[model samples]
Target: MRTVRYEVLPAKGTEDKVIAHVPRDVVVTVTASPVKGLEPTLDLATRLAAHGYRVVPHVPARLLRDDVHLKDVVDRLRGAGVADVFVPAGDADPPAGAYGGALPVLRRLSELGSPFDHVGITGYPESHPLIHDDLTVQAMWDKRAHATYIVSNMCFDPRLLGDWVGRIRRRDVTLPVHVGVAGPVQRAKLLSMAAKIGVGESARFLTTHTSWFLRFAAPGGYSPERLLTRSAEALTAPSSGVAGLHLFTFNQIAETERWRCALLDRMTG
Candidate 1:
C-alpha cells in the first residue's frame, strides 16, 4: 500500500478532530486559508507536531509580506520541527506581500538554505481556470529544481491523471507525484466547495463538468475508492513514479479516516 497524507483545513474545531480521528502514522498537511491567514496554519501545524504527527503545512506565497516574512515563517516551522511544506501560488487577491507566486518564495527558501527536508509544488492535471495549459506545464518544468515532489491538483478522471504524469515526464520534470484525491465528503458541500477552492482545482473540474454530478453524487456521496483503484495501474507503473496518495479531507477527518480504513480492509480482505 502507498503512503497516505491527510490534508486538513486550519479552521476552528479542526485541530481537535484531527487529534481524535487521524492516526499519527498518516502524514497530516495543514492548509493555509486566504481568509484566516498563515498564523492559524502554523499554529495548527505546531500543535499537531506536538501531538506526534508528521505534519506538512501549506506555505502559500501570496500570503507572506516579503522575504523577511518568509524567513520568519520558515524559522517558525523549523523551530516547530516541521520537515515538510507545500508551497502554492496562493489565491490571495491583492497579495499580502512582494511574492505574487510560489517561485519567488521557493527561491528565497533555497537561498535561506531550505530548512525543510521535503517541499512540494502544485501540478495541474487539467487546464487551469486562469493559466494557459502550456504555461502550467512549463511552470512545472520551471519548478522541478526547487521542489522535492509534485502533488497534483484534484482530478476525477484516471486517464487525465495518467496522461498528466506522462506529459510531465516527457517534459523531464521527473519528481514523484502524490496523487491528490478527495476523501469521503458530502456531495453537496463538495460541489459547492468545488466552485471555490480547497487543496486543488477540484472546484473548476467538478462544477464545470455537469455530467460528473450523477456519478460523484451517488446516494452516499463522493467516495475515493473507484478513482484510486482505477489509478493503481498508472500509479504503480515504473515510469509513473507515483509516491503515494494525498487525500483532501475537506475537514471530514472522522469520515475520511473511516473510509480509508474500510477501503484498506477491503483491499486486504
Candidate 2:
C-alpha cells in the first residue's frame, strides 16, 4: 500500500470536525502557525492520538524557546503516544531563542534520544520565495542524517517535481519522499486559510508561481489526477524512491477526504 497522509493547520475549534471526519489510523500532520504558536498544534495532536489516529505534529524550530522546551514537547508527544514528527524552519520573523532552523532542532532531538520513529523534514520542489535554491538543496544534505524521510512542500508542476526528486536522489539524499499536492481546494479559501495562519509567503509563492495559481483559477479548478498521472512515471520508477502522496488539505478536510476516497476507488476498480 502506498502511504497516504494529510496536512492540516491548527485552526481554532476545528478539532471536532477533524475527529468526526478524518478516518482512524490515518496520518494527520498538524501544522504550526506563527501567530498561534505551538500549543494548539500539540493540543490537536494529543486529541487526534486519543481518537486513534497516528498524528505527526509540526515542530517549528523558530517557535521553540530552548532545549528545555524541546524536551517538554518530546515528553508531551511521547505521553500522547505520538511517534511521528515533522520539523520545519518556520516563518517566525526572528526566531524566539537558540534554535534558528530545523537542523538545530533535529540535532537536539537526537541528543534527547530521538523519541519519534519517523522524523520528517520539508522539501521544496519549487524554489522557496525567500531562500535560494542552492541553500535549500544544501540544507537537505545537511539534515539528511537526522531525518527519516522528506515531505515536499506543495507544487503544481509534476515535471518539475519529478526532476527535483531525481536531483535529490543523485545528490545521495535517499530518504523516501512524500510528494505534496494541494487537495480539492477553492482559490479564495486557500488564500484565506493561508492568510489566517500567517503564512504570508504563500501569497508570494502564488505570485511567483503564477502558472500554478492560474491552473487553480480555471473552471473546475485544479485536479490532483493531472499531477498524479504526469508524475507517475518518475514517482514509480525504481530510482525515484517516491513513498506516497501527502495532501495539503488547507483545512478542507471533508472535500480532501472525499477526493482521496474517490480516487482510491478508481485506482482499485
Candidate 3:
C-alpha cells in the first residue's frame, strides 16, 4: 500500500507543478496526449530524470514515424538516464507512420536490444470505449511477451477491476497488474476541465462509462480511498498479481500526495 506511482500530463506548467509538489522518491510516468504527440512527454520526462526522479515516459506507437524515429527516441531517453517506458497504441486517429500499434514498436525495441529494463503495456480493466473487451484481452495476451508489467487504464468500478484481474489470471497472463485510479480530484475541477476540453469531449467522457460518471457525479465527488478500500480483497488476493497503484493525478500533484499520505496514515493507525 506504500508503493504507488504518479502519472502526469505532458502539458505546460506540468513540469513546474511536479517539481514543486511531488517528491523525488515517487515513480513518475509521463502520459502522451494523442493530439500533442510524444515530444512534450519526452521533454518533461528528460527534465524529471535530470532532477533525480525515476521517470517512465510513454512512447505511444502511433506517434513514432518509423524505426528511425524509435531509435532516436530510445537514444534520447537513454541519454537522459531513463530505464523505463510505457508503450500504448495511442488514440491517434491517423497514425503518424508505419507503426499502427504497440506490438511492432515493442518488437522493434527488442531488436534495438531493449533499452528499457521496465516496459509497461496497457490493460483495460473495464471495456475500452472504442475497442471491444475481447480485443483488449487478446491484445494483452499478444503484448505479454514484450512487456514487463501491465498498467490499467482509468477504471472507477473496483468490482469490475477485480473481475478483470481474475480473467487475466485465468488466461495465464501472469504479469503484475498496476491498478489505475484517479487521485483526489475535485468536482469543480472536473467540471472546469470538462468545460475547457469542450462539450463534445466532456459529453463523450461523461456518457461512455456509467459507473465512472456516477462516481464522478456522486455526492462529495470522487475519492480514491473509496475504491482502494473496496478493492483491497481483489488487490491482495492470491494469484491476483496486483503489483501496486498507478495513480492518474491529472496534475493534481499536491492533493494526490496529501491523499496518499492520509490513506497510508489511516492504514497504519
Candidate 4:
C-alpha cells in the first residue's frame, strides 16, 4: 500500500481543526518549527497522541542546547508513546545552541538510545537556500545509519525528484524515502501559510528559484492530479527506493483529504 503522510504545521488551534479532519489510519507528523518554543513540541505531540493519530513531531537540532535538553525531548516523546520522529536542522536563524547541524543532533540521538521505531531526516530535491547540494547529500549519508527514512522537501518538478531519488540510491544511501509534495493548495493560501508559519526562508527559497514559482503559477498551482501519476510511476520502479508520500497540505486539510480520497478510489477502482 502507498503511504500518505500529512504535515501538521503548528498554528493556533489549527491543530485541533486539522486533526479533526484527518482519518486515524493516515500518519500525521507535527512540524516542530512552528511550535516556536520548547514546550509546544511536547504539548503538540501529546495532544496529537491523545487524539489517536500516530504523531511524528520534528526534533530540530538547533533547538536543543545540551544533552539534558535532548534527553527531555526524547523522554517527552517516549512518554507520549510516540514511535517516530523527523529530525531536521530547522530554519532557526543563528543557532539556538551548540548543535550547528542535523548530523550532530543525529549522533546525539543515537547516543541517547532512543526507543523510536522510525527516525526521519530531510532531503531537498531543489537546492536549499543556505546549504549546498553536496553538503545536503553528505548530511544524508552521515545521518543514514541513525535515520530510518527520509522526507523530502517540497518540489514541483517530478523529473527532478525522480532523478534525485535515482542519484541518492546510486550513491548507496538506501533509506526508504517519503517523497514530499505540497497538497492541493491555493496560491494565496500557500503564501498565507508560508507567512504565518514564518517560512520566510522557504518563501525566499521559492522566489529565488523562478522556475518553481512559474511552474506553480502556470495553470493549476499544485494539484495532485498529474503529480501523483508521475510520482507513482517513479516510486513504483524498483530502483526508485521510495517508501511513501508526504503532503505539505498548507492547512488545506479538507481539500487535500478530498483529493487523496478521490485518488485512492481511482486506484482501487
Model 3 RMSD vs true structure: 2.6
- The lDDT values for all models are 0.84, 0.84, 0.83, 0.79
Per-residue error at 87 for model 1, in Å? Answer: 0.3
- lDDT string for model 4 (1-269, tens) is 24889876666775776666888888887776634755676688788888888888888877777778888889888988899998888766676788877888888888878568899998988888778988888889989999999998888777888888987888888999998877888887786676567442465667677777777777665666677677667778988888788988776788888888877898799
**Candidate 3 at residue 27, lDDT?**
92
lDDT of 4 at 36: 77
Which parts of model 2 have CA positions greater than 4 angstroms off?
198-203
Q: Poorest 10 consecutive residues of model 4 by lDDT?
A: 195-204
What is the per-residue lDDT of model 1 for residues 158-209, given as tens digits with 9 covering 90 to 100? 8888898888899898998998988778877677765554554556567566
What are the runs in model 3 whose C-alpha is more than 4 Å off?
Answer: 191-206
* C-alpha TM-score for every candidate: 0.93, 0.94, 0.92, 0.93
Q: Which ten residues in a row have the lowest lDDT in candidate 1?
A: 193-202
Per TM-score, what order, best first? 2, 1, 4, 3
Candidates in order: C-alpha RMSD to true structure: 1.9, 1.8, 2.6, 1.9
Q: Give the TM-score of candidate 2.
A: 0.94
- Give the clash total for candidate 2: 0
